[model samples]
Target: MARVAVVTGASSGIGAATAARLAKDGYHVVLAARRVDRLDALAERIGGRAARVDVTDPSSVREFAQGIESCDVLVNSAGGALGADPVATGEPSDWAAMFSVNVLGTLHVVQSLLPQLAAGGGGTVVNITSTAAFVNYEGGAGYSAAKHAQHALTETLRLELCGKPVRVIEIAPGMVRTDEFSLNRFRGDAERAAAVYADVDRPLSAEDVAECVALAVGLPQHVNVDQLVVRPLAQAAQHKVFRGPLFER
Candidate 1:
């Protein structure tokens, strides 16, 4: 039997890419997400298993964890910026949704699997947060705040789980180029999504983030990567970017 890995948000983007990579790394990847069709297709392509999981629901996560015999790695890559714009114009629903996924969802998965992780003796927990966790943005208030809370949780977990063999690491990616990322940001506004990357020569890709995750996961059980922050070359800072003229034709 292969080492088991539970990956959330595995239908697309970083989650999907990481799931495939981990399977190649000799683990039987179990993917969980809200999108069933996408999950089925991805599972077929990668020869892995899929579960319809809503990370926000404790019952769903509990059952999902129980289904796995022994989970070796838990990747919390199931969050995004939903309606995370200026506070004045943001709706309460959007704020609630962001907190539910970014904060509660992460907690739900961890809480459900803490016993499993502990029972297995040593495992890895990689929380996929964003640069917003350490930085600031005028329109990224809510998103940043939630990531900040996650960052705190990561640190606390690390401290509490010390000497227990569990490695709690946090990867903070910057400007990852993904369809879901832009779509989630713009709520499927293709024009706006295109505009966000119109000028950038290149941005972070899912593979790039997945590579980082693989590196962190492959480390010896004694080695622990506390935190990592990565961004594209063009993205020197979150607010600053390199762009070309829209009509430079």
Candidate 2:
């Protein structure tokens, strides 16, 4: 039997791309996401299976894990930025939502699947964090805080699972121009989303992030990549985005 790989947030963007790449790599990919319709479509295309999973819900994650008899890899990509309000003006609810999905949700999925990963003989766990994990920007308080928490979790898991058969990894991407990430962060404001990547000649795409995930996970089991930070040449830092006609390079 082929190895089993579970990918959260597999309906679109990085998750979908990673699932497709892993499928091509010969693993029987299992695409899990909240959008059943999209998941089914993607699963059909990749010759994988789809599961309707809401990573934020512990019961849902537990059930999903139980359904899979064997799992060699897990890609925790089921997270998003909720709002861009500054710390002082940020909605507490938005902050809570981000934490629930980005931090706590990752923990829940790891807890549920760690045993399967171990059983499969030194598997890998790839946590999809972001540049916000280690940086701060105005109007990015909520998302940054949540990603920071996730970074902490990823590090702690690596240390705690030291002797175990699991290798914990983190992939942090900067200036990724996905269809939903900025749009959802701006509360569906199309103009605001478009302006986020307006002047950048090239921004990281979902496939770019997926390539990172595939590289990290496809490494020999003895090789563990602790973390990787990916950004477009146009992005030097979280706040250093060059814009406008004169700034374009």
Candidate 3:
């Protein structure tokens, strides 16, 4: 029997790419996301399964987990930044939403599926965080704070599960230019989203991050990659990005 891999946020972006990659790697992929249409389409394309999952809703996640007989891997990718407002003027609702999904959502999913993971002898849990988890910047207070909390959760989970068969891992990507990430962050401002990658020319792609996830999870069961940080060559750090001709210099 093929090992089952459950991936959240699989409707698009890194989540979708990771599902595809894992499918190609011979695992039975269960694509989970809020959009049924996209999930159905991707499941058809990859010969996988789709489940409508809203990670923030515990009952919804519990129902989703109940359907799975076993899970060898759980990829928590159902997270995104809501707004880029400064702390002084940031909307409380936006911060709350971000925390609910990026932080609480991860916690809920991990708790719900942990038993399934353990049932299969050992499994891997991959948390898709951002460089913001470690680096603070202007206008990124809310999103960064939520990711930092997620990072902390990942670490604590690792420590708590030290003797268990499960492995906890985190993948932090920088400057990934996905279709909806920036647009959603800027609240549908096309021009602003476009400008976020205008000069970089070669920002990280969803597939790039997916490849990293695959690499870490594909390792031997006895080996665990605690954390993996990935970034485009143009991005040296959170506040540093090379643009235009200067990028190559």
Candidate 3 pairs with clashing backbones? none
Local accuracy by lDDT, each model: 0.87, 0.92, 0.95
TM-score of every candidate: 0.94, 0.96, 0.98
For each candidate in turn, give its C-alpha RMSD to the true structure in angstroms. Answer: 2.6, 1.8, 1.5
Best by TM-score: 3
lDDT of 1 by residue, 138-241 (tens): 87888888889888988998999987978998999988889788787778888887777786877889989988998999999889999988888888887888
Shift in Å, residue 87, candidate 3:
0.4
Residue-wise C-alpha lDDT for candidate 2, range 77-150, written one tens digit per residue:
98999878778788999999999999989999999999899986678999999999999988998899999999
Better of 1 and 3 by TM-score: 3
TM-score of 2: 0.96
Q: How does model 1 fare in lDDT?
A: 0.87
Ranking by lDDT: 3, 2, 1
